[model samples]
Target: MTDYNAPLRDMRFVLHDVFQGPALWARLPALAERVDADTADAILEEAAKITGQLIAPLSRNGDEQGVRFEAGQISTPDGFRESWHTYREGGWVGLGGNPDYDGMGMPKMLGVLFEEMMYAADSSFSLYSALSAGSCLAIDAHASEALKAAYLPKLYSGQWAGTMCLTEPHAGTDLGLIRTRAEPQADGSYQISGSKIFITGGEQDLTENIVHLVLAKLPDAPAGAKGISLFLVPKFLPEADGSLGARNGAHCGSIEHKMGIKASATCVMNFDAATGFLVGEPNKGLAAMFTMMNYERLSIGIQGIGCAEASYQNAARYANERLQSRAASGAQAQQRIADPIIAHGDVRRMLLTMRSLTEGGRAFATYVGQQLDLARYAEDAGEREHAQRLVALLTPVAKAFFTDNGLESCVLGQQVFGGHGYIREWGQEQLVRDVRIAQIYEGTNGIQALDLLGRKVVADGGQGLAAFAAEIRAFAVDAPVHREALLEALVRLENTTRWLLAGVASDANLISATAVEYLHLFGLTAYAYMWARMAAVAQAKLAEDAEFCGAKLACAAFFFERILPRGLALEASVRAGSSSLYGMEAGQF
Candidate 1:
């Protein structure tokens, strides 16, 4: 079984120590009254219990059983419906949704923590709920007040689930090419006709109704993305009493059987003149859809972190308990027959790398979450702008780096198990498979890099980079200890930022080609800064309690000494530019 205890401890450290999140939460009037340290801790404790006891046990089963499609219906793995029932009954679906619409109104910072736990427990099961929550966020942000009052409550209560329908047969990342049409009807509604592929939770047996926020073009609309519009298409029409009424024209033509996250029910949806309501303004669908897409990007990153946490726990347990070759130091004569693999330096190295990345990733996520919260709730205009810039700059990094590291960490965790890692029984391989999608979906890591380098870095005149560099500078200057190491990382980041700005204008391809490496370098440097800050906090806490704080400080040192050095390689790779990546011929593959 995967151990969630350590992960939860790390979460608390990130929340209380690294972020002092509760203190910030106290500043926002709406969130202040509802969430305090005690309440937040209680929520986290309950979340951990639900995740470990309920969700983790079902992970492998969900992956194995997958989703089944018969006729026009979709059925998830056995026990998933029951688990989802418990999940919704607990009001988890609305954990961070809008309070005005009957959601729990938890802060995104808190939601990030629970999301990490959810993903760690079972990413397959977590994805369905994530889609609903993400869709709710988008709707809450952009949908009309009537729509919010009508649909948000049901989505929050789990009476219904929500999905963002953007991908079509022809359009994945390029929404300008979408063929879906939404024509205005006499009743002031629209009739939607189109096919959407890879529509997760498009149609499922889990909820009473499915609410799809779709993107389509109006018949008279101009060509390309500017002509697009967003529409709300429900699986079933609503009755006067707000209950599900007649079935709509939308149906799941089929469900996809894929490499991982099988229980998610990726669907190919067919909307045949589906009755729909326009969301936001006409010809602004892409902007509206991005409200949800951005959140999903972060959620997917959490998925990666969750898988890495799971893999690390499983691998660590195996290493400690599974006796193998003798210690290299010849220190344990009593167990001379065989020593645990953990006694080997390489195994320890892998485990530490996993720990550093996982813990650091969570901290960075919370940091981003704090910025998101501030962007909405902060009283000062400058504060909000600062927060927004941070969100914009770090969002891509959080989405790409965390997910990529999640896969890397999980794969490394699997390798620590040797051949047993590849086998099905151990569940290590499942984690590797589950985390792979994070890198591919929610905008490929490559695209995320391009956005970071092109839009976030250069287009904004390096404002985002400047803000992030400022944050790093503040941390290095103010942090009680480990200041030098943090400063070192910041210095490296500053130099890289200058290089990116200088190169982007002269040779745009240079930025595009080297974007991924620069993003990684930036991510690793940022993570290193976070780890150093966390280590400083952990070190101070050690004076109060030795054992608890000691382990944390050790993990911090492990991150700086062993993991932070990877930034050097990332920096080197970025300096290499796109020459190697783009120069190859099409037939080279």
Candidate 2:
């Protein structure tokens, strides 16, 4: 297995050269004083060094050791606790955290790359830190000042960690069906009683305390998701002096033995009348939970990219080293009995597909990150609102598309390795196992599609999609290359979106049955738009760095010529409607 390396060059190309991230950051007053191009570059270099050097080495052993649950206490694999201490002390847990609490105050554009590298290096380790960052986001946005002061510093510093407790044995996607109860007490806290399953980083040896952001119902609350409230429940309650005090009622019942990310503990937590504090307003916890959903969802999406990149690196390295039959075009290396597999057309195709999709996904992720920055830090309200709309429109795509393509990319990388890919020690199989969850978790790829097509697009009469299409068109107008191909895909997206929005009201199950195809169609178009923008930038800078810009242009061509055409099939599937999907009765063979 090849060691994982952060794609710092492409990351820099996307951040500075293509998207003008520094320019965007400079305009946002919140980021202006905090970050610059050099600072951002330095962060990237340090992150690359840390992830590649520190975390990447632990992946194989961590997977083998997994997490140990002994007498209700869950311990991480060897080296994890020490790594976590180092990571936390470095302030990485609060890389994009609120500056008010000593966070580095970096923007999402930078965070996305860091996350990609972390996940790529070691997904299991990344989850512990990812959940902490996500929990901090929710608390910073919705929690009270006191709660923030008490928890934010420790969490940001990595002294403490956080987890989101929403799923139960019976409730997965349907939060409305959750039975967890939150009863108010005279002391201005609540008593939380619930059992949450599939809680990532719920109970680990990495941190001093674990802050669980749990969802439950108030005593007087109405039924369903609307009545659900978010509570801040701690494993170890802190005293007034900010030191660890009494143990809370929350306990780790056990952890799951999973197919992938074995090193990360997936716990079944029991909150036996645990003392809890409300995060946001009463009966509005669902709303509050979603405030951080965007961030979490995006981070999860990057997991796919990271794993794909890791797999691709190994596959690419193997393809060059593994000797095989001479290329169909004849011997390229006269010294060897057979040429490297890389000389084969099919192998080249697979490698290029992985590269194109991974690179395009990176660009799209950065674009979404840029919008996140705009949504939070833009001086103009209109810009902020528009950025939010774009975020709502694209977050699902970022999650589902990146992951779906991530799996595809990983599979392709595996295929390039032939039989060796299946071997456990090679790490290709591990990448496949680890990335598989990204499609299943963070609200599943299917749920993300429904949210994208049903809520973000159809519910708004496709205004969000329309605005996105317009932006693509606007970019294509000045694009240096592949303008026509981008427009063609955009038109297809617009038409498919029209069909979906128009039919969703009449056919209630339209979104459910066809949303995946709709999302793919949208994803293809989105990547095409990304390629067009990137191609334009690469074209202009061809003179400065011919080799780098040339590679960018080649990848863009591969995306447009070799990959983007998949949109046609997806559009057709969406237009086919849900009739065939629902035609069979439940009992039918």
Candidate 3:
């Protein structure tokens, strides 16, 4: 694998040039005093250094060594524990956390970029801290002030790690089916008893304690999702003085040997009457867990982007250096027997597809981060509501589309490597294995598509989509290039959304059948818009920096010409309805 370099240039281009993140930060009162352009740049630089140096070197070793499970304790791969401490010391875990409790208070717009970098450098190592940040968000949002005071600082400091335990052997997406039981105690704490499977960072030797935000049903609670309750269960119970106390009942029964992210300890956690404190309210656990789940959904999406990026970097490097067949036009390298494979049209096509999709995914994710920042920190109520609506509508799309595209990008990167890509030692195949889970976990891509079409679009009558189209149109007006393409794509997205909304009423199975395609239509259009915005910025700055800006223009053009056309096919499939899907009976197969 080629040494990973954090794409700081592209990231800066997206943040400062395309998104104008610094100006946005200056406007938000919550971020005005906390961050600036120089600060963000410095943070990104520091993050790039650590991720590229400290964390990245461990990725190959982590994958090769994986995790060792002996008896009940789980030990991470070599260098992982020390790297975790180094990461913790850098205050990165709290980059976007609540400042009231010692977090760095960076905006999501910036934090998401850092996340992308970390995942790119080392996905397994990144998982340990990623879950902690998400749990911190959930705890800060729903837990009591006392609980926040107790856990947030330590969580932010990385002195402790956190995990969300929602999935069980019998339940995955269906939270209502979870059989975990939480019985009330005399002093208000409860006894959490059950097993939660596929818990990331569930059992690791990196931290002093592990904080598990668990979901369970109370005895007197209602059935299904309504009956669930959120609880804070720690491996080591904390004393009143903010130090470790007695060991709680939570234990790692065993760790799963996963397809990828092997170094990440995916555990079957057995909470045997563990002492736990209730979070939020009884029968409202699903609502509260979403606080963390949604955060994780987006983070998982970034995992795809990160892996795709790493794959592209290695593939691109290999393409340029690995000499093979001669160029069709002529022998580009006269001194060598054959020119580099990168000279071939098919090779260039593969490389461009990876480049366009990965860069566009970065831009799209940054846009979502901007919306998140606006939702939480915008001054006007109208602005906040608008941003929240867009966030709601796009969160699933971001999760599903980015990941689906991430897998595609990674595959293309691997394809660029031809035979070498299939080899494990090259690291291209590892990226494919690692990124596959992004589509499955944190709510499967199919589930995300259904959520987007049924819940976000149809339930709201496409109000959020309409607002999103309006934003696209507004951008199209100012976009120096690709304006017409952006506008046309916007119309197509709006029309496809309307068609989905209309068909869902008449056909019960229509939404689920076409949800995936509908999401792609939306995602393609979103990327087109992102490309247009990027092209506008790049065009304006062309004279100052011709080479960089010119490349941006070329990428945008490639996206518009080659990539955006996929939306047309997705639209056609959406219009085909559920008839074809229903024709296949279970017994017929």
Candidate 4:
């Protein structure tokens, strides 16, 4: 396997050229004084060094060594504890965190790119940090000032780690069915008693303390999702002076033996009358938890993109080096025994597919991160609202489509290695196993599709989607070469939206059956828009940098020609409706 590189050039192209992150940051007062093009570049450079030199080396070891759980204590891989400290010392844990609590307060646009690099370096190792960031977001957003002051700093500094305890043995996606209970006490704190499974970083030896943002039903709570409340439960209670105190009632029951990401501890956390403090209003926990949920959903999406990128880098390097057969045109390397596998058309196809998707995904993820930054930091109220709407509309799409495409890209990357790809030593198969969880967890891709179609599009009357399409249409007008393809994709997306909205109301099964395809259709159109935007920027810069800019244009062309056509099949499937899907009765298979 090739050594993992940060792909800083492509990252910069997307950040500085395609998204114009510097200009965007300049407009936002929160980011203007803090981050500029130079600062962002420096941050990226440092991030590249850390990920490449420090973290990437631990990936294989993390997988092979995994983790060990004994006597309610979990141990990470050999180097993880030291690596976690190094990462935290770099101030990466607070990259996008609030500045009020000693965070570096970088923009999400930059954060996403950093996240991709770290994830690509080592997915299992990355999870420990990612979970902390997500937990910090929830605390910063919904937790009381006291809670924030107490937890945010420690969490941000990596002195203490954080976990989102939402799932139970019985509850997965349908959180309303959770059995955990949180009872109020006289001192405004609550006693949280519940068993949360699949808790990433729930119990680990990496940090001094673990803060759990738990969801449980209140004693006087109503029912279903509305009845749930969020609690800030710490593994070790904090003193008034912000130091670790006695251990709380939470412990690791056991850690699961997982399919992949084995180094990241997936623990069964049992909280028995754990001392806890409420985050937001009572019975509003789900809403509060969603702050973390949304943040994590996007982070999980990046997980997919990251793994795919790692897979592509290794696969491309392999394709260029591995000698297999003569080039279809003739022997290009007569000095060698046989031409490299990259000489073959099919290998090039796989490599290009991986490249186009991975690069386009990078741009797409950055775009969403830009929207998130605007939503939070934009000066104007209207701009904030518009950005928020777009964030809500596309968050699910980003989470689902990026991951779904990420898995497919990883598999394609594996295929480029042929039989060797299936073996574990190559690391290709590990990427497939690691990225597979992104789709299944953080609200399954199917749930994301329903959110995209049933709620974001149909329920909102397509206003958010229409706004997105208008942006694409505007870009198409300026894109001379790719205008037709961009416009055609916009039309397909718009038409598909209309069709789904029209039929969804009449047929209850319609959205469920067709939501996935509609999401794929929307995702394709969005990526096509990204390609057009990148292509326009590349075309303008081709005179100055022929190699880099030309490569961008070539990838955009591949996207429009090869990948974008998948939207046609998605559109057709979406238009076919739910009739054929619901024909079979229960247990018919």
Candidate 5:
């Protein structure tokens, strides 16, 4: 097993250079008072320590112990409960929540960094925090003032945990098919009846209660996705005095036995005429669920980035320590048996690839996080609207591409270890298995691609793309020499977006069949742009420390020379279209 190390310098580079943290915080009233550079840096350092020191050591043990279910009760792995207590006591779960609700009210950008670090250390442990933050976001957005006042405090305090219950046995992404029903009673509460599957943190012993934000249909509601409504169903029904009362009607039937993330509880939940209160207007549930879903999408992207970073660190460390064949030029001066594996060009290739992707993903996530903050807190309406559209446009890409990179990066990391990577004790194999879910869950990467191409770009008549392109072009115009790669990457993205838009009206299938490849191309181009921007900024800061700047420049060069060409392959695949994919008849086989 490898010890986790927080990439502090890299995080600082991205926070200060890539995103301009101070200026952004100065613009938002909610975060303006406490989010200067020093405070942000301190927060990141503290979060990194907690994740690396407290959470990382428990990862392997958590996996080994898994979550235990006995006699209708659930218990997390050893050390997890202790870590959860530490996390809550440190005010982490509420890092981005409303201040009035016992939250620290940090900006989403900062919270995301903390989140990625946690995921990097132990994703299974991170789930409890991630789900709570997500639930708070949704409730803050859609729930009544009373509900937010009542639930957000406890959730933020980590006295209680939260779960989003949208997936049922018959539906996951297609919520239109969900059969969960909510019937109104005389006292303003509703009776919720249905089963929710794949609910992370649905039922757990880590908290006093589990608050469920469920989606169900009202009897008088319209049909399909339009008819669904959001509800707040807490495990322990609250007293009028705001204290815990009797237990609610919902319970966890069982926890999933999965291929990975065994320590993170995924439950099958049964809401047996559960007492529930509507969070939003009737039949407006899908819109509200999206509040949580979109947040999770970005978090899922971070999951990918985190696991990739973890895998890369392990692989790089192992390569440096393990002696193998001599360098290509043959042993210059014999030290021991041959030389370290890091001496090989191919090994360097894998390490550089991982570094480039992981760093790029982190930068991208921060960029999106900044947009989210601006959308909520910027003074200008136009800026806020633009930020909102950009957030929507980029969320799916971040979620899909980053996770795709995550899976590939982990696989490559495993590949570097050869047979040892596949073995259990080495831990590399576990990462390969665990990171796989980020691609599948939180809306499949395929679904995310379809959303980006179909809804965000084509359906909007290129408005969102135009807004993003205009900003990138503005940045490219002012950027320095090495930023030329960023300019090229943006140009490629613009051309690809234009091509997809042009073909969409004639063939809507352009995105349906080609969306996944388009997503990959888009991700590579965006990441390239991000890497170039980071390198250029780091270079300017080099007088402060040349070694750190040199590393940034090296990673940027590696991305351009080795990784950016992947855009071409993905673009070619996207242009290949559905002719071959859907052409074969059912009888062909």
Candidate 6:
């Protein structure tokens, strides 16, 4: 891979110029004292340094070495443990954690850029801390004050790490079908007994202990998902004095030899009567877990962006450097025997697609981060509710669309390398492997699509869409460059949403059948809006910084003319309905 570099200028543009994140921070009372533009810039710079220098150097070695399982202990790849310690000391893990608990208290808008940098540097390395940050959010939001006091500081400080254990060998998507048992103890802690498979960071040697936020059904619990409860199960139980005590029942049976992210341990956790504390209320675990899951969903989406970005940097560099066939019209590099691949039209298409998707994804991820900050930190209840609604509607889309597009971007990057891309030497293949899991984990892309189509859109009768469309229209009025195109796209989205809502009542399978396309349609529109906002900023400031802003305007034009048209096609596919899907019987094949 071309030495991984963080797109700092692009990140700054999206955060400060496109979204005015610094100004937003100034407005939020909680962040007003904690963070400023300088703080964010310094953090981004520091992140770019360590991630590129320390973490990135280990990525290739990590994947090559992978994680080792001997007896019952799990050991990470070479350099990983040391790197974890370095990251821990820097207070990078809790960049977005609550300040009350020793976290840096950075907003998601800035935290996300750091996240992108880490993932870009090393997917496996980023995941270890990603889970820790996410679990801290869940604990801070739902756990009792006592529980938070016990775990929050250590987790935030990176003295300890965390994991979410929900999937079992028998259960993957359907939490309702999980057979894990949580038995109450006379001392108040429950005995968590179950086998949770595909548990990321379930077992690792980097930290003194591992905190697992588990989901299980109590004996007195009702049937189905609503009956489940959340529990805090640590590998090493803490003493009253706030130090490690006896080892808990959580154990890693074995680690998966996965397709990608080999350095990050994906374990099969066996919780054998582990001592656990209840979080939130009885039979209300799903809601608590969602606090972490939703956070992870967005983080995972950024994984896609990061992977695609790393791939693009290498691909773009290779395209400009490697000379093969002459240009279509004639030889551009007369000095060389043949022209560089970048001179070809097809090569330009691939490179531009990678740039457009990667950059647009960065913008989209930041926009979502803006909403998250508004929802959590806004003082006004109305603003908070509006932000929360947008979060609810957009979270799944962020997870699904970013990842799906992330994979495509990575593939295009690989394709740009041609035969060289297929080889491990180029590092493009590794990225392709690493990025594939983003689509499957946290929640599968299909599940996310269904959530968007069914829960967020249809369940509300498109009221959420209507609210969101109004906001888009309001922005479009100011973004004169792509105003009409954005407005037209918004109308198409509203009409398509109405179309989905129009038929859900009559067709039981409508959501499942067209959910993916519907989400892409929404995602395409979202990106178009994002590009329009970007283009608007780039348009007015052309003379101030022609290279950066001009490129933004050009890319926005490319997105509007080329990529945005896919929304119409997605709408058509959604309207195609479930009839074609149902006709294929199981035995017909």
Whole-model lDDT for model 6 versus the true structure?
A: 0.93
Predictions in order: lDDT: 0.87, 0.92, 0.92, 0.91, 0.88, 0.93
Residue 147 of model 4 has an lDDT of: 93
Per residue, candidate 6 scores C-alpha lDDT tens digits across 1-589 of: 6699899999999999999998999999999999999988999999999999999999988999999999999999999899999999999988998888999889999988899999999999999999999999999999999999999999999999999999987788899889889999999999999999999999999999999999999999999899999999999999988899999999999989999999999999999999999999999999999999999999999999999899899998999999999998999999999999999999888888888888999999999999999999999999999999999999999999999988999999999998999998889999999999999999999999999989999998988888888889888776779888888888888888888788988999999999999999999899988998888888888999999998888888888888889988888898999999888898997
* Candidate that would win on lDDT: 6
Estimate the TM-score of every prediction: 0.97, 0.99, 0.99, 0.99, 0.98, 0.99
Off by over 4 Å in 1: 1-6, 333-336, 582-589
Query: lDDT of model 4 at residue 492?
Result: 89
Report the C-alpha lDDT of model 1 over 193-280, residue by residue, as the tens digit: 9999998898888999999999999999899989999999999999867988999999999888888888888999999999999889
Residues 1-589, candidate 4, lDDT per residue (tens digit)? Answer: 5689999998999999889999999988889989999999999999999999999999888999999988888889899999988988988998888889999999999999999998899888888899999999888988889999989999999989999999998889889999999888999899999899999999999999999999999988988998989999999999999988999999999998999999999999999999999999999999999999999999999998999999999998898899997998999999999999999999888888888888888999999999999999998999999999999999999999889988998999999988999998789999999999999888999999999998999998899999998888777776867899989999989988888778877899998999999999999898888888888989999999999999888988998999999999999998888888778987996
Question: Model 2, which residues run further than 4 Å from truth?
Answer: none
Clashing pairs in 3: none
The list of candidate 4 runs beyond 4 A from truth reads none
Model 2 residue 472 CA deviation in Å:
0.9
Instruction: Name the lDDT value of residue 193 in candidate 3.
Output: 96
Ranking by lDDT: 6, 3, 2, 4, 5, 1
TM-score of 3: 0.99
* Model 1 C-alpha lDDT versus the unseen true structure: 0.87
lDDT of 2 by residue, 473-571 (tens): 888787879999999999998888887777877898888999899888888888888888888899999999999999989988888888988888888
| Deviation (Å) of 78 in candidate 1 | 1.0
- How does candidate 2 score on lDDT? 0.92
How big is the positional error of residue 334 in model 4, measured in Å on the Cα after superposition? 1.7
